[model samples]
Target: MTQVVFYILPQSLDNEPEDVSAHFIQACAIAAFYYGQSNKVFIFTDNQQDAFSVDEYLWQFDGDSFVPHNLLGEGPRYGTPVEISWQPPTHPRQILINLSSNVPKFAINFQQIIDFVPASETLKIAARTRYSTYKKMGLTLSTHAVTNDNAVESTKKAED
Candidate 1:
């Protein structure tokens, strides 16, 4: 069964548009660090710009730390631990970190799926819909409300 995790960000919906990318990058980096390079991760975005921005952010996410990643078509398909893509991944059962607005049809194929619920009412409503869809599918689900106070500690723990 797929494990779905919803991470609610500390930022309010008013600031969601501005800080969503940062939140997404931070969450992805932590997951990459925790899962390590052996486990492949796909960070899905809705557009080329978002994909490229995520690719760049992953590179500079941690000043002293790094996550091995590449844009979907930039390099060899298999070796890179993380892939930033606007399309579906070629591999099945990999970790999926979704930054898109809608639920992906291919989401059921992933071993794990992580998504964010921004503080914005509109985004949160969409996230709730996604959560309901996953629940209807009978997937194992979990939620973490991320706050500024615990964000650093959570990242640190994932690093370890």
Candidate 2:
């Protein structure tokens, strides 16, 4: 099994603590839906004192159709504490999706950081479209399509 892990970083114009949490949770839900469509098991890990709050919020979105395992830290120091100053709460939020032997077709296309942040309605739709595209390609939800050599060559030419 291969596990693809994505970490969500909060983006807020203001330093309001509440906004940070809200954005992080939204990103988590978006990521869960995308991964869930591939029939992958999704796990959420966070360091918030009220991780359950975020979990409950995500559970409210029914259309997502992804049941995620919530892993919360009791406090900043749970099992082992790392030394870092000014640790952003969002940095610790992560979504781990486990795939079978095959890699999903859309994995490479959607791996860009922008796909998982600020979860918006447009982004949700795009994610669904990508998921459906993979299904129609006769590829298993966990199967990744081999990259075309020509596409690689084109990219290399553009860089040069």
Candidate 3:
């Protein structure tokens, strides 16, 4: 069964209410941490702009954390350690960092999924729909709370 993990952001980043950059940062951190463990990661964005944003941010997310990644159609045929795309990954990956509004139909192809529940109420509602959909799929699901202070480390901090 696929395992789904949700990282709930406690607050918006940079004091911008409901800012999405926080989600992107956390997703990058998680992808980098998993890549260190030899996991193939795919970041599924909502659109081309978001995919490009993540591709750019992943490069400078941290001075010490380096995640070799490329935007879909720009990377190697099989892709790098991490791949950002507005579409589903062509090949199955070990982990998926979903930054979309709804769960994609190809989500079950991955062994694990990393999703986010933003600080905004409107976003949370959309997240809940995804949560319910996953629950109905009978997948193993878990959630963790992340704060701006620990967002980077929180990826590696998941217990069990």
Candidate 4:
């Protein structure tokens, strides 16, 4: 069964017009965590702009640790260990970091899925639908209350 993890943020920046939201930043952090685990990851975005936003952020996410990634087709044929794209990945990834509004149908292919729930009322409402969908699939579902104070540590140190 696939494991689904929802990271609940302390604040809601889901409606931000720019890509500078905490939600997006946390996604990159989580992606880096998985990359450090030697797990191939696919970061699914809501649009082409979001895909680029993540690809750019990963470049400067951590000054010390680097997560080599590319935007889908622009990278090597099979791509790097981490890939960012608005469309489905051409190859299977061990983990799916979903930054999209609705879950992708191909979500079942991944061994694990990471999602975020901002502290906004609107996003919370939408989260319920996603929760139910995953539950119905009989997937192992869990949630983590994420605060800036403990965000980076739980993901494990990149240098470790």
Candidate 5:
């Protein structure tokens, strides 16, 4: 049974297009922490651009640390803890973190799925739909509403 979790990011104050960069960095930090715990993570983006963005941010997310990761179609780099892609992982079965607008097709492949809903109403609605879909699928659902304070706490927990 796949366990699906949604980590809702703090709502943006302004009405600009949700800057996902900070969220991505936070996601990367969480993934890196899980990697430390010996879990492999596959991050699914909506498209190649998002994948590239994640790839770049992962490098600079932590100046002192590094997360072993590669973009999809780069050939499998054995020992990489993280894999970022626009498509589902070539080989399934890992902790999946989805940044896609819609629920990924391969959501069932992994034992666990982590997704986030930003401040945008459009995104919130989409996430709701995904949540319902997951519910209908009979998967376990867990949600964490991330505020700035808790976001910092999560980062600290990940670091520890």
Candidate 6:
């Protein structure tokens, strides 16, 4: 199964470390839902001792109960796949989810949310939007565009 991994970083690492930590936890919940599996969702932080604390907070949400299998101390490794086993909801709903922040080098994947849509029409719509955004931006079709387009579209709608 394809997996989505998000590298969590503190927003400032200076003034608002706590807020950045809170945002990281919230992002994990969103990531869990996007991946369509809460059970096997894995988060990687900046190899800090406090990283587990953020994971603990994220696991407390309803439908967000997941066990942590820490990979921090595994030592220098390259391209290791994190294991995940998520039971999808019996009846899923179409949701226009958006996650944004004034941070650089952030990414989210569409495969995370694709498993939840049971309808072909909804999937097609998502695909079209994803394609259109990629065409406009001249960037490769990626999960980041699918996730970022929500914010871009919202801004366009607001301006219109």
Q: What is the C-alpha lDDT profile of model 5 across 41-89, one tens digit per residue?
A: 8998889999998988787666676888888767464537888999878
Candidate 1 per-residue lDDT over residues 1-160, each given as its tens digit: 8888777776632223354454575556555655564667888888889888787666666667677778876677563778878898776537888888888888999988888887777888999999999899999988776676666355443223
The whole-model lDDT of each prediction reads 0.73, 0.33, 0.86, 0.83, 0.76, 0.32
Q: What is the alpha-carbon lDDT for the whole of candidate 1?
A: 0.73
> What local lDDT score does residue 96 receive in model 5, on the 0 to 100 scale?
86
Ranking by lDDT: 3, 4, 5, 1, 2, 6
lDDT at residue 121 of model 2 (Cα atoms): 60
| Predicted candidate 3, C-alpha RMSD | 2.1
Where is model 4 more than 4 Å wrong at Cα? 12-19, 156-160
TM-score of 4: 0.90
Q: Model 5: runs farther than 4 Å from truth?
A: 12-22, 75-79, 155-160
Candidate 3: C-alpha lDDT = 0.86
Q: Can you write out model 4's per-residue Cα lDDT over 72-122, one digit (the tens) per residue?
A: 998799999899999999998999998888888999999999887877888
Q: Count backbone overlaps in model 2.
A: 4
Q: Output the lDDT of residue 143, model 5.
A: 80
Q: Which stretches of candidate 1 lie over 4 Å from their true place?
A: 12-20, 35-37, 155-160
TM-score of each: 0.84, 0.29, 0.92, 0.90, 0.85, 0.30
Model 3 lDDT-worst window of ten: 11-20
lDDT of 6 by residue, 25-135 (tens): 444445444344332333434334445554455455345345333333342232112211121212222221222211112223222321111124544355355445434
| Model 2 Cα lDDT, one tens digit per residue, 1-160 | 2222222222332332353343444344444554544422222223333444445555554453644434333333331111111112223322223111123333332222212222346544544554455456543343221122321122223213
Off by over 4 Å in 6: 1-20, 35-41, 63-160
RMSD to truth, every model:
3.5, 15.8, 2.1, 3.5, 3.5, 13.9
1 or 3, which is superior by lDDT?
A: 3
Worst 10 residues of 2 by lDDT: 79-88
Decide which is better by TM-score, 1 or 5.
Answer: 5
Cα deviation in Å at residue 159, candidate 3?
A: 4.4
Question: Distance (Å) between predicted and true CA of 68, model 2?
Answer: 5.4
